[model samples]
Target chain A: MKMKCTISYDGHLFNGYQVQPGKRTVQAELEKALAILHKSEDKVPVISSGRTDSGVHAAGQVIHFDTPLSIPAERWPYALNALLPGDIAVKTAEHADDGFHARFSAIKKEYRYFVYTEKHPDVFKRHYAYHFSYRLNVQKMREASEHLIGTHDFTSFCSANTEVRDKVRTIYELDWTDTDDGLQMRIVGSGFLYNMVRIIAGTLLDVGTGKFSADDVKGMLDAKDREAAGRTAPGHGLYLWHVYYDN
Target chain B: MKMKCTISYDGHLFNGYQVQPGKRTVQAELEKALAILHKSEDKVPVISSGRTDSGVHAAGQVIHFDTPLSIPAERWPYALNALLPGDIAVKTAEHADDGFHARFSAIKKEYRYFVYTEKHPDVFKRHYAYHFSYRLNVQKMREASEHLIGTHDFTSFCSANTEVRDKVRTIYELDWTDTDDGLQMRIVGSGFLYNMVRIIAGTLLDVGTGKFSADDVKGMLDAKDREAAGRTAPGHGLYLWHVYYDN
Candidate 1:
């Protein structure tokens, strides 16, 4: 039987989500804990919905693995959490349908980024929020987001080194709200390419700072070139907020 | 001229606020940064409002130092912050009156403590908030705080090893509010004894958990013995919120 788990991890503790040689990664840690629970020398492979880059956090990341052990669903979180490090936690665990796949079965994903707009760095939020002192016109950024709300080819908003050839993706929602200390941008989409969220966050800053007008977003979308958009925002400010699967 | 500076720091990086022989400390960092700004071989001493133990955060900690440089008041924050480490920051700096002292002249001080009530630990807030899963009765805690208000000898709330002979202190206000995540207690007083706020927080938990009643607080005060009170809450949960001075 396949088991599904919802996990939350602080990105600062790990190198990234994937397994890397001689580096501490979230996947390696999870598997090592699972191996101990399973009482097996051979590690149980855990599959994640997606990989987050170094310094990118995830609160609602989904993962799945096949297990022979029949631990109750309610007790799985307690069992796994005991072995997991302080930076990672298993929030929920339950049996998944045989058809369910952690990544392939996901219908939508949400990504959120935090930008601290204050001129002075906030001591408490230095690790979680990206300190961006640049002047931002939120109205202009909102206007620019309106143009990219629907299905579009987001080649210009993803990294040039993205492994995926197809860049067409549906962005269901793109919203930004002014928080007390900074700005929070939440984007929901069918799927994302490599560095897609970070690039979009960076490109929106150009429109917000008056370098590129809201109208230029349409032109950049048409160009389908990586250079047409702005710089890629840092990974430290990005969080994989949620993943949705059809009921 | 004597310059006053309001500083903020994440106490996780410091051993304590005071300058120790070789351990990293908030005062040591501040003075080291100031020594570079003064361009002198001798360390420019930085005096703070009071010493906070290791892992106690401070957002409005005031410091004072006599400086020979003629930097503008507006430029002091930038000048000092540039030289300080990431964990410590100078929020504001201005020329203080001849008699103003960071510790001696302060009229009142506010200390805030955060308690996370969730059964599971929060990954992001681990450094800032104390994780307490014990059942808490906010109303009972509030009633207990009423007895602590006004002039009283807080000998029972302070550590027994405290060097100060006099333990009498006046609490202007003791307020606890239920936040979304947990409970936040803010205590304002003329001054605090060593570990006073933390011990009060711990003792209030006894009241909140039914180990003691609201009326017992007065008896604890009358006892004037540290053993009469409950345990000390962890230092990481406490924050020196602000200092009130006569304008």
Candidate 2:
């Protein structure tokens, strides 16, 4: 049977979402837990919507795995949570269609980046937000993000090491909002390139700090050069907020 | 010159607030940072409003120390923050009058306890909140908290090892509010006995869960026995929210 599960994790503890040899990764942990449930000596492979870098959190990461056990769909989360570490939890579980794939079938993804603008970092929220001690112009950042919406070539915003040749992607939504602690940037898109969201956040921060204007952001998009964009934001401040699938 | 400072700390990394012989503690860390600023051979002693237990946090803890150096009051926070670990930060600093003392002059203290009632704990807030899977009756908890307000002998709520001769304390406020993620209990008091707040939180949780009633809470207070109250709630969920002084 095919099982679909939605999980949330404190990514600070894991190396990343991918299974890396000798490193503690989320995928490795999930596969191990599933293997334990099945009493299998061999490692079980689970597919996730996408991989998140180290120290990046996820509120609603979707994954799917094949299981031989006959446990009810709803009970899978409970069983997995009992075995999972304190930082990782399965939020929901259900049986998926035979053709369903966590990654290939996903239609959209949403990501959020948090920035703490206080002089002194918030002790409690330090782990979840990047403490950027500079004053930000929210109006300028909003205006800059407006230029980033819709379909465009994001090569300037992607990591230089990415092997994927396609730089074109559709950004469904791009906006920023003020939160109690600081500013939060919300971006929904058809897909993202390697380090794309963080780079976008960094670029917008530059705009907020008066280093760049809204027009400069558009110029960077046209340049399609990684050097034209701002530095990539730290991974700790980014969250894989949600993944959407066309059912 | 005497300096008064307001600080906040993520207490998960410290053994506790006090300076234990070989343990990593908040006081020790602060003194170390101070010594670095003074470039002295001896550790500088710091006086805090009160001590917090291991795994507890503080949003606004007051402290004072005498320094031979004459750094401006406003610059002290920036200096100390440069040396202190990421978990601890000096929020503000100012010169104190000769009569001012962090502990002796404190007039009020406020504490907050967070309880995550979700079946699966929130990954992001796991460090700041206690995961309580049981359903709670908010009204019952509120009703029980009312009996706890006003001046009372808090012997039943104190730890067994507490050596303080006076068990009487004035609780100015005791209230609970439902939050988006969970329930938060806010308590303001003139002074708190050792483990008093945790015991109160645990006892109220018991009342909310139907293990005890509002009247039962009153009986336990009158009993004045340590075992009469519910178990002490874990330290991680407790936050020393604020410390107030007449100045």
Candidate 3:
């Protein structure tokens, strides 16, 4: 039987979401716990909707796995959560259609990047937000983000190491909001490339700090060169906020 | 010159707030940093308003120390913060009157205890809150807390090993509020005994879970015995919220 699970994790502990030998990773931990439940030495593979970089958190990451146990959907979370570490938790579990795939069937994803603009760092949120003491013009950042709100080739914003041939992706929304703590940027899209969200955040921050203008951002998009875009923001400030699928 | 400083710390890393031989403590760190500023091999003693146990955090802990440096009050934070670890930070610093004392001159203190009642723990707050899966009746807890207010001999709520001769203390406010994340208990008092707040939290938790009633709490208070109260809640869930003093 195929099961779909939604999970939330504090990503500070894991190396990343992908499985690697001898390294602690989210996928490895999930598989290890599942294997323990099955009482087998062999690895039990679990598929995630997407991979998040090291130190990046997730509030609604989706995963799918095949299990031989006859546990009910409601009990699956309880049964698995008991074996998983405190940093990772299975929020919900449900039966999925046989044809459903966690990654291929996803229609949209939302990512949020947090930046703390205060002069002094917040002790509690230190690990979760990028502490940049520079003053930011929220209006300029909003103006710059407007250019990013539609389907376009995002090669300039993607990491240089990405091997994917297609660079086009649809961005449904790109906006910023001032939270009580700091600035939060929300970006929703059909798909994202390697390091795309971080690069976008960094570029917008430059515009916010008066280093660049909205027109400069549009020129960078047209350049189609990774060097034309701003640096990639740190992964610790990023969060995989949500993932959506068409039923 | 004497300096008064307000500091906040993530106490998970320190053994406690006081100076103990061969232990990583907040006082030791502060004194060591001060010694470096003074260029002395001898330890520079710091006086804090009070000590916090291991894993207990603080947001507004006040302290006073005598220094030989002529650095401006505004620059003290910048200088000291550079030497302190990431977990500890000096929030503000200012010159204090000669008669001021961090411990003796303080008129009031506020402490907060956080309890996460959900079955699943919050990933972000796991380090700061106590995860209690049992259902809690807030009204019952509030009723029981009312008996604990006003001046009373808090011997039952204090740790047995406490050497302080006086067991009497005044609780100005003992109230609980429901937050978006969990239930938080705010306790304001003229002073607190060793482990008094934790014991009170545990007793209130008992009342919340139907293990004890408001009348039972009154009986325990009247009993004036350590064995009469509930267990001390874990130290990690407690926070020194603020310390008050007259200028």
User: What digit string (tens of lDDT, one per residue) describes model 1 on residues B1-247?
Assistant: 9999999999987998998998999999999898999999998988889999999999999999999999999899999889999898888888999899899999999999999887666778788998888889999999999999999988999998879988999999998999787899999999999999999999998898899999998899999999898889999999999998897
Q: Relative to the unseen true structure, what is the Cα RMSD of model 2? A: 1.0
After the best TM-score superposition of candidate 1, give how far the Cα of residue B234 lies from its true spot, in angstroms. Answer: 0.8
Residue pairs in clash, model 2 = none
Q: State the local distance difference test value for candidate 3.
A: 0.92
Give each model a TM-score: 0.97, 0.99, 0.97
Q: Which stretches of candidate 2 lie over 4 Å from their true place?
A: none
Q: Which residue segments of model 1 deviate by more than 4 Å? A: none
B1-247 per-residue lDDT for model 3 (tens digits): 9999999888888999998899999999999899998898987779999999999999999999998899999999889988888788898999999999999999999999999988766777778999888999999999999999999999999999989989999999999999888999999999999999999999999999999988899999999999999989998899999999987
Per-candidate DockQ values are: 0.66, 0.76, 0.66
Instruction: Indicate the residue-level lDDT of A137 in model 2.
Output: 92
Note the Cα lDDT for every prediction shown.
Answer: 0.92, 0.93, 0.92
The candidate 1 chain A region of ten consecutive residues with least summed lDDT is A118-127
How large a fraction of the reference contact set does each model reproduce?
A: 0.42, 0.70, 0.42
